[model samples]
Target: MNLKLKEKIRESLSAVLPITGIVLMISIFLIPMELGTIVMFLTGAIMLIVGMGFFQLGAEMSMTPIGEGVGVQISKLKKLITVLLTGLIMGIIITISEPDLQILANQVPSVPNMVLIITVALGVGLFLALALVRIRYKISLSVLLIICYAALILTSFFVPKEFLAVAFDSGGVTTGPMTVPFIMAVGVGLASVRSDKNSADDSFGLVALSSIGPILAVLILGCFYKPTQAAYVLEDVETVVTTQDVARIFARGLPLYAREVLIALLPIIVVFFIFQMLTGRYHKWQIRRIMIGFIYTYIGLVLFLCGANVGFAPVGAYLGKQLAELSFNWILLPLGALIGYYIVKAEPAIQVLNHQVETVTNGAISVKMMDHCMSIGVAASVALAMLRVLTGVSIHWFVIPGYFIALVLSRFVPDIFIGIAFDSGGVASGPMTSTFLLPLSIGVCEALGGNLMTDAFGVVALVALTPLIAIQLMGLVYKLKTGKGTPTERAVIADDCDMIVDLEEDE
Candidate 1:
């Protein structure tokens, strides 16, 4: 209704149309897509567009401000123990609600669903505390990452071969739609309370750190559990006979998601309500507007999930199976690369992150630049994912080297770039990667007689890993040209209010 909301919608549409058009053209050419399937794709696309619009609006209205408020309050508390506890609790709560984690948990055959969820949550909670401590003490993110990864590599050897890929993939999926906006905003909020120049840079590593929790936890799970069975059960689908049937189906599905999104959002809502009661930070008018925005978010998430899970997943699985069954299975590499490029553009959280990165860097890091970096990274990751299925390469071979390069590059990039790079890694792998890409990979792996847990499971992890190097490489280039030092000493520079403005005006 308002100008800002309209602009957000415009941005969402900009992202959706290109992918929709490309997919449509390709479907018409490559496959004998039926009318019903076409309708399903359109329904999913519309849901994605509207979902992005609503989710972004809700994040702006509710998550960002609330996270920033919480960050300020937590900083004022000034006690290291309290700050660490707050971070840990929030991490657990947020990761538990993560939709991406659920997507992953359902696919894993070895661990009990609740056990996997709790393990992942605990992992996130522990690392989130470490992230908070890093912010509090102004630790070098690169050094911490190196040390943490050293532990990851050492742990990998003891873990079973089949579970390793899934374990790494969990790192990427754990920071999904529900987690990204809140955690990133929390970083921004916390960074805002400090005068550190690197505060903006520091804000990004939260998503990066939170991703680490699941990898470690899942790896630990693998040590004790052997994944003997591949969980690739085909979901039941009732073919809709007509347009009205599709409408009825969506309507029936809507309420289920409405309930789920509301439940997912309840913790943050309650936290905000309590914060408002105590601090009275917002006026009545502001609360009314935010509540309305939250309603849109709830509706948006419901449609988005219903459409994606019901409409998109089966299609992805079918396509991957069809393609892999062909003599030309290797063709999945370039085709997947093209899809990965376009699909990353469609990820809801990526738009928010792209805008944030452009802002934080004062247009020094443009959205187009970020998009280009992510596109290339995703393109490469998807290709690798396809390759993994065809060749059955170990995930550690790719991930260890990929992370090693990313960690080493972190030392050379500007502090802001370091933060943004890690954040980009998480944002690049959002809901779409888990829902579509993971299924696609699994289908292909199943068709190819590859180990599902090992071959298909690390697609999300690869998606998350590549961006760290890509974005940091972008930063390295920027620094080489501009000669800016890593913002280590100026991590807490006072009075750089332009950070907020920079994010807001991103083109």
Candidate 2:
């Protein structure tokens, strides 16, 4: 276990170092931030590396086992209502536990936090159950995505303009690092019960369908709830003066996030205990391991969130404001693009999703491919978001067409890629995007005196949007390279007896 954690930390270091380097370079040459602030950022980066290491290991042990156990048991049930209800209840509980959703809820000032959280939770529960039904019935993922997105698009017209960005953003934010692994493990468990050729493909779409719930839920809420756009304010971050000041900041911050992570993780623990009570699924030793995994998860998240919120966020905001105020402010466009290019790699959930994809697809979609594709997709999205900040362009201008293209491409790509693409969209926009990139955009928008709701927001939505198209396009290239229904396709997603096959896009 120690060796495994060391490996995870090493991998995390590789993932995080590039973005950390970029920030250091920018601080030294471009922004020239206060030494104390730079020290805080460095501290946060260290926390991130260690936290991510522990989080990944913990998730694999805890979330994976519990979710898979639940999924397998649920799939074995003879009655449909029991399965659906189980899915619904599980969805609601897990989503309510999501720190990301809680973060997003606080961002919307007009709507009550509990109200928005419940609404979004209900949406996830319903859609997650729907996703299960789709898998059970062997329904085409493309058709369902098209229908749901169309409803979401039509619903947007009745929504107030200010709420649009927030609504779209809710979709991305709800599927952050905390939720993706468990939700996906359930899908894997559910699919493992089946012997059909399509189970692997079906397993990939749960996150995709689960992502749509927040958008639809928030958009519907927008129709009735009128928000006061100008009332939205960016919270001011406190300045650090000395080494003790940075230590004091983290010392104070850790407990707050520790409480938050505890609250977020409690429901899951209760559910697991209930599951054990009813199912007697695990051996005593297995139960002990899971409980330990939970502890690791708890500690990891507290550190990760504290570093991100207390350390990275203020620096991101300050940098954006400073850069946008520059005489050569046009540099914001390129600089944003460049930072975004590397930042997506640092998202902890991206590692989970990449590993999951490779495992489920039997290496058909390599981690290297997923990494490059995600990076490029996110780069483009952030560039476009920076443009929106500079010019105050409508989100629908990018989103509507982007989704349209993604949906259109879905028809042409392999069935597996459609699910992978949409899932990537959600995974790409993880906690990092929320805590750092969102604030950066807000800072730029604040500096330019743009509508914060309209211009500054939706960075997350864009982050979630482009990967849908970018990944499916990679699938298109894969299709051309490996033709339809070829050995690569079949072998990549085969049973245990099949050998692992590699399909490269040549980077």
Candidate 3:
């Protein structure tokens, strides 16, 4: 247990260091921040590392097992109605509990928070059931994606321009830390039942499909809740001049987040308890471990939210505004790109997705490689987002072409890569992007007098979109590399099964 915790902390350190160092460099050389702000940012970075470590370990211990157990049990049931209903219940429960979704719900002022939350949760439930059906029936992921996205695009025309970016952002944020681990594990559990060679590939794309649902649902809601513009109000960051002030800030924020995290976690815990009572799936020891995991997850989430909202968010906004106000405001593009590249590595959900992908592919796709690809993709997305902020370009100019390219590339990449690529899109836009990057973009947009809804709102969507293209491009390269190989030879090239074994033992 101690070893696993240490490993998680080590992973978080590696992920957090690059971005923290970059931020410090930027503060020193480019945009000079207040000493108080710098202190807060550094403190937040420390909390992020510690919080992510615990959270990832907790997820591995709890969410993965519960999701997989539920999935496997549901798959074994004979009735199709039972399977679909189980999925619907699970999806709604999980989506409602998602911390990222709650952040998003609070941001959009036009819709009531509960109304929007319920709408998005229902969408997740419905589509999650459809995803299950797709897996069972061997439905083609690429074809389903094309059809769903085509419909989403067509619907976008009817949605008010003010709501367009928000609609897409909804999709990206819905598949956050709470949702991703559980949904991906559910896919793995469902796929494990199949004997076919493609079953492993099929264990992905649930996240990809689930992401689309909220976009569609929200877009439909937009038709009715049309607003000329979204009203956004940036919160003021209190100055912190001393270590005591910083401690006070975190202390004040912690209890609020503690309450929020408890509220967020309660429903899921209840669901798990009911499921266990009905099925008796877990042994006594496993239950104890999972309960401990829940405690870790609770503490981690509270610390993470307190640190991120109190410390990182204000700094992100301040940086964006300061950079954009420069004599050469265009520098925000490259700087934003650089920050995006490293910031994604620090996202808790991204780490989970990378580890899962490495495990699923038996290290054919190394976690290092996945991290590199996601970073590049997010870097490009931030560059484009910054460009939009600088030039006041319509988001459609980028998003339409981006998704078109992603969908088109879906035809050429391997099946597993398609799943990983789309899943990566959602994973890439977890809490970090929403809390930090979104505020950063909004700060820039406000400084530049750009429409916040159109220009700033789509950063998360773009963050989600780019990975779809980048990972698939990696897939295309991978495909070409093994094109001439026989089946066994291709298997040998595609997986490091022996190496995976050694790595597991080392762990």
Candidate 4:
């Protein structure tokens, strides 16, 4: 009923309309889908669009500012114990609120969801403290990544092969819609304390570091237990008969999401309320605006999840199964690659991230450029993942080398890119990877008699990994073009690490 809410709904519908049209176009001309399925797809599309709109707006209003506010307040404190406790509490609370993590937790049969959730939360909490320490001490992002990854690779050999992908995905998905905006905002708020130009670079590696924690924790868990079974949880898809029925479907779906998201969102709302009461940091109007934003986010997430889980997820699974059942299972690779490319356009956290990168870099890293990098990164990861599904390739073969190249490249690229590239790694694996792509992979694996837990589980992890290389490679390219000396000289460093500074003092 409110004007802003109405505009968000309209915009969301408009944004998703083209996607709906594409699906309809394919159904009518390219693929002959059942009419009931088509209706289901459309209904899901509407929910997804509106849900994304609301969720993103809500993140902006409620999550980002609150996280930033906390960061700013926490930074003002001098006690080390207080900072550590805050990080632990915030990490636990935010990770618990992350629906994507919960989704992954529910799917794994070997580990209890609560156990996995707690382990992942502890991983995040520990690393969040580390991230804060890094910011406080101004630690080099590249060096820290090198050490963390070295540990990851060393652990890979000992951990069970089946759990590798899920472990990596755990890293990426933990930093989800609920966690990212707040965490990133906290980074910015903390970084704002320093007058140094390079402070913005420090704002980036929170998600990057937080990401490492889950992989390590999950890998350790993998060493302890082996999961031979895959749990295939089928979602309930709604059947719509008429155009009018779409409204009724959304109406029914909305309240359920409203309840769930409101519950998910309540902890942060309460935290901020208490925070504001103690600090008096926010104005009355500011609080009012955030409340409105929370409403938008709540409505958006509810619709988004409902639509994704109920509508698109089933279709994706069905399509994968159908395609795998055909003689042309190989087609799944290229098709998955193509979908991975375009679907990046639809990921809600990715959109926010790309916009943030463009803003922070003063358009030096354009959204178009960032999108291209992510599309390529995601495309390659999906292609590799699809190939793994077809041939039962171990995800470690791809991830270890991919990370090696990224880590090596970090030493060559600018420090800012080092931070952004690693952050982009996690950002690439948003809700879409978990909800749509994972299910799609699982469907194909189930049809082909491949181990779904081993083969299909790590698509998100791979998606998270490739961007580390792609974005840093972008930085490598930028250095080659703009650096004062020979490319060969810049590429190799023997002792003097400071020789590679391109624009060290932020432009």
- Model 2 vs. true fold: TM: 0.94
Off by over 4 Å in 3: 484-507
Q: In model 4, where do residues sit more than 4 Å from their true spots? A: 1-31, 236-256, 484-486, 489-507
TM-score of 4: 0.90
Error of 2 at 106 (Å): 1.2
Lowest lDDT sum, 10 consecutive residues, model 4, at 494-503
> Lowest summed-lDDT stretch of 10 residues in model 2?
496-505
lDDT of 1 by residue, 221-329 (tens): 8898888876657553457779998788778878877777888888767877988998888899988877876776776677778877767777777778778987767
RMSD of 3: 4.6
User: What local distance difference test score does each model get?
Assistant: 0.80, 0.87, 0.87, 0.79
Task: Answer with 1 or 4, whichever has the higher lDDT.
Answer: 1
Q: Please count the clashing residue pairs in each candidate, in the order shown.
A: 10, 0, 0, 0
Q: How well is each residue in 272-353 modelled by candidate 4, as lDDT tens digits?
A: 8889999999999999989988887777778788887767887777776777887867877887787777676677777677
Model 2, stretches more than 4 Å misplaced?
230-237, 485-506
Model 2, 1-507: lDDT tens digits are 589889988988988889889889988888897777788999999999889888988898899999889889988888779778987898899899988887888888589989999999999999988988888788999999999999999999899999999889889989977789888899899889899888888888888999999889999999988888644345555678888888898999999889888999999999999999999999999999999889988888888888888888888888889889999988888888888888898898899889999999999888988998898789999999999999988998999999998998888788999999999998888899988899899899989999998889899999999989878877776775566656655444343212112334233
Per-residue lDDT, model 2, residue 83, is 74
- Identify the superior model by lDDT, candidate 3 or candidate 4: 3
